[model samples]
Target: MKGRFWPKARLGDVTCVMGTNGVGKTSLLRAISGTHPRSSGDVTFDGKPLGQMNAHKMAQMGVGYVPQGRDIFPLLTVRENLQTGFSCLPKSEHFIPDEIYQLFPVLKEMQTRRGGDLSGGQQQQLAIARALITKPKLLLLDEPTEGIQPNIIQHIGEVIRLLRDRGDMAIVLVEQYFDFAFDLADRIVVLRRGEVIENAAKQDIAREQLLSIVSV
Candidate 1:
């Protein structure tokens, strides 16, 4: 994840990371989430320096990561899968919130169903809901729209917007879908060969210019 950097993200804003495949977009997220080791540099959250912490430690510190591929427990029921997020919470906060169901109603209906039984989009929704269970201050989403249907993508986009409008958390979204990312981003960071070629406010860059940069 070297040579990749962006400005500090403020709460209530969406920062979209876009690039061609193999440009370390996912790796960048892994570094932030502490799912992968950070060889160098520092990551600070809420004005505190997070130096070489593990995934669990980061989660405890309010970093919620929904990685690519919707990695849900196949044998676990939808409710069970979400309950896994409780591991990062205190005993008093072990119960799932009604807002989780409110955000994704389909998960409420499939509460008892196994995660593997759900479609790709359903699994994606479950993955996101599970992350929200931690009530994270920083949410990292990697390719949420990948392999998802148009309708679900739109739903997810709306959810992201709602979450942003809530002004409670900061979101870092890694996406390859051009228009989808562009439409939701408050700021844009474009990467190439693990290097950041462009980083600017959404209003500062034209859509066509960004499309040309990533397309190259």
Candidate 2:
């Protein structure tokens, strides 16, 4: 099955992809982000083919990826981790946007702390903040709430909502938490064994039916 995303080039538009485990969810993100090579199919973004573009190239093309594991540079300070995203931007845009701090004030407070020293929730915030540093046009987030505390999960959801409301970048979220995905998604795509089994707008699909589709 194939899933395509064509952003209206506006902010606050969100596409949520949901599925059971091992259903090629992460593979899809890897292919789009150019982190893993795809043997077939085409990925076109903004009317251009993304053929053979490495992760760096994808980043330069305004794609920001926050992988599932919240991968952070353990030894680096939070500020330094954010600075790494500078490679994707021009020298003039090197500074972190004030909005990032506004979205996650904890990051600013822990600017000098090593990434590994932070708790699970704090690390996740840092991962997301680092991605935002690139000021991407398309943001890919994989399971932002996994392993996080309940309060932090709610906070993460709030941040996602805020990002969407700003309406500058399109967000593609991969989440297994059905309720969370349902709340933020303008549209939902469900997959099974790498096949798209369900695709519809949130209001168009009934809640129970959508749950059954993904469960299958």
Candidate 3:
């Protein structure tokens, strides 16, 4: 799968890729996260080509991926779902961080609830929380706000802002919602047919400008 409409390019702090449906946003993430291997091009981390690594290797190297559609274990309890990230860590460091719960308190209250029992927003939160437990350096989120409610969206935005402000992590977001992506992204990447059309900082482009890129 290749980026449609939106070209592949780099942005500041964030290498965001945006476009309409079927633009391959999810596929770009899949390639970067190593879920689907890239046909070419180099995905480098700390100056190393990511193509040389595997999924587990990528995680260990600090890339946390929260894919599209909130892929949580429907039957698994919230706690168990979080525990899944433990595989990315060594035995000594294998424990869900307290910050994870602090970041998404709803998860604390619904600890015993099955992932599928939660609403779409709650499931999305759980899915993100599960990723945060891994303590990634480069967090890859694919349409995190998709199908989520407004309040939850705000919370997620704050969380993302906090993570970015920390300055230790690099975030790559794939989004269709202009306002949502614009607000959270330090920079934006516009996709238009497996190619990067525009990549610039938030301060560099206005809302209308972004809308024009996504409008097909």
Candidate 4:
């Protein structure tokens, strides 16, 4: 299926994309990230064609993707895993920023710990911190709340809100957790079968209507 995210103007600071499982939510992110080759259609970021670019190029272009399962290098130390984001940066920008630690203090404490040693919540935080290391303009988060503890989920939500409030980047969150998304999104995009079914500002559509659209 073909799809595009050409918002009339700029996308909101936080845009939540929702659909049931197997509805191509992850596929959309993969396409945008250039991680999966598309059969057709061009993807452009800030007027640059992304269809021909590889994942590394996408990252270098300021697109940070935190895929669903928090893919951290198990054998690598927390610090080492975060540094992997440096692959897209210059030598001078190799060091991790103190801001990343501020956003996730647990990561600062676990800097020397192996990625495999951290709890699921900590691992998720590490994954996000790793992506932030690139200082992306577009951040794509997939099911960030999945399998996470409530307290950790709350903390993650706070971090996301803080990021959005910074007014620097656009966040596209793909989530099934309705309450979580509703609370944070400035707009909502609902999809079904690889196609966008509804795209509207969160206030323009009623919650019941949005729920029904996704259920269809």
Candidate 5:
């Protein structure tokens, strides 16, 4: 996770981390989300020093993570799966928001369906919806477009855009899909062998140049 870092992210911005496989993209997100321990360096959230807290603490501190695999509980109904996010909230705020259903209407259609029975795209949406239920100030999405069909990917992109434009949270998206990431990113950080090779505002870099850099 050691690299030349960017300035503190502002709410309403999307910071995309791009790299080839085995270059620690997922590892970076895991460390930031506290799912995996960082070997070195400090992590600060909301201008406060967060020194080696666990995942639950991170969640409570308004950090929501949707891991690479869209890890929804297989046996749980879709409604129950979303309810899992209730763990980090006060009991009074336990109800799922209507906006969650608006974001992914299929979830509402299949509320009683088992998570395992949903399509991959459906599950990805559920995973994101679950994280949104926590109402995070910082959302970390890792490889969200992987294995997703085009239409669903577009839908997810729109959802991310809406979330970003809402200006309530900062999104850190680790993506291998170049076009999708490039379109959404306000700033881009490129990594090679766990070190940052490029970090710049998206306007400062050309699409072709970014593709060439990551292709290597």
Candidate 6:
């Protein structure tokens, strides 16, 4: 994740960190997630600066990150993987809500299965479900459709649409798939080298323009 804008890194809104491979998309998300520290520029949420926030504090403040890899605990049962999200909440509030199942009923069906037993798409769903259990205001998704079947990709896209339509959360989608990103993104931020080369609303740009902007 090295590129042009290691010199300047700052983002907000429904920012899509898109570019050719190796343009620092993951690094940017990692920086925001506190998994990777910014060499410089501050990361903030809801207008409150992140100068004071660490990883645990960021989660408490509702920053959810679904990293590039679907890092579900393969040894744990599906239910146990979801429960890991509860560690962020108070003891009284530590339980999975029904809405999470509504978002992914496959999870409900496989609650007893070991995480390693699920398919790739199922694992992706579990990863996202794990993140949502924290009830974040800002969701960072990294190449969610990468390596999944088309049907599952559609489902994941629909889920993202539903979340964005709710309008309470700001989503940062880091993707290499132009078509998938186009369908769900409200705004497109194309990165080249590292700087934000083009930032435009979906209404303001076309597919070719977006593709060209991010093309190396």
- How much lDDT does candidate 2 score? 0.88
Pitting candidate 3 against candidate 6, the one with the higher lDDT is: 6
Per-residue alpha-carbon lDDT of model 4 for 8-81, expressed as tens digits?
21433798989889999998788888888888877778876665778899999999999999999999999999
Model 5's alpha-carbon lDDT is 0.94
| 42-94 per-residue lDDT for model 6 (tens digits) | 77566677774567778888889899988999999999999999887899878
Please provide, for model 2 over 47-85, each residue's C-alpha lDDT reduced to its tens digit, 9 standing for 90 to 100: 787787899999999999999998999999999999999
lDDT of each: 0.95, 0.88, 0.81, 0.89, 0.94, 0.82
Worst 10 residues of 6 by lDDT: 3-12
Q: Please tell me which model should have the higher lDDT, number 1 or number 5.
A: 1
Per-residue lDDT value at 186 in model 3? 72
lDDT of 5 by residue, 1-216 (tens): 556775566799999999899998898889989999988878889888899999999999999999999999999999999999999999999999999999999999999999999999999999999999999999999999889899999999999999999999999999999999999999999999999888999999999999999999
Ten-residue region with minimum lDDT total, candidate 4 = 3-12
Q: Determine which window of 10 residues in candidate 2 has minimal summed lDDT.
A: 1-10
What is residue 33's positional error in candidate 2, in angstroms?
A: 0.4
Candidate 3, residues 23-90: lDDT per residue as tens digits? 67788788778888777777877766666567787888888999999889999999999999999888
Pick by lDDT: 3 or 4, better one: 4
**TM-score of model 2 vs. true structure:** 0.95
Which sequence of candidate numbers ranks them by lDDT, best first?
1, 5, 4, 2, 6, 3
Candidate 1 per-residue C-alpha lDDT over 1-216 given as tens digits, one digit per residue, 9 for 90 to 100 = 445466887899999999999998999899999999988878999999989999999999999999999899999999999999999999999999999999999999999999999999999999999999999999999999999999999999999999999999999999999999999999999989988899999999999999999998
Clashes of each: 0, 4, 18, 0, 0, 3
**RMSD over all Cα atoms, model 5:** 0.8
The candidate that wins on lDDT is 1
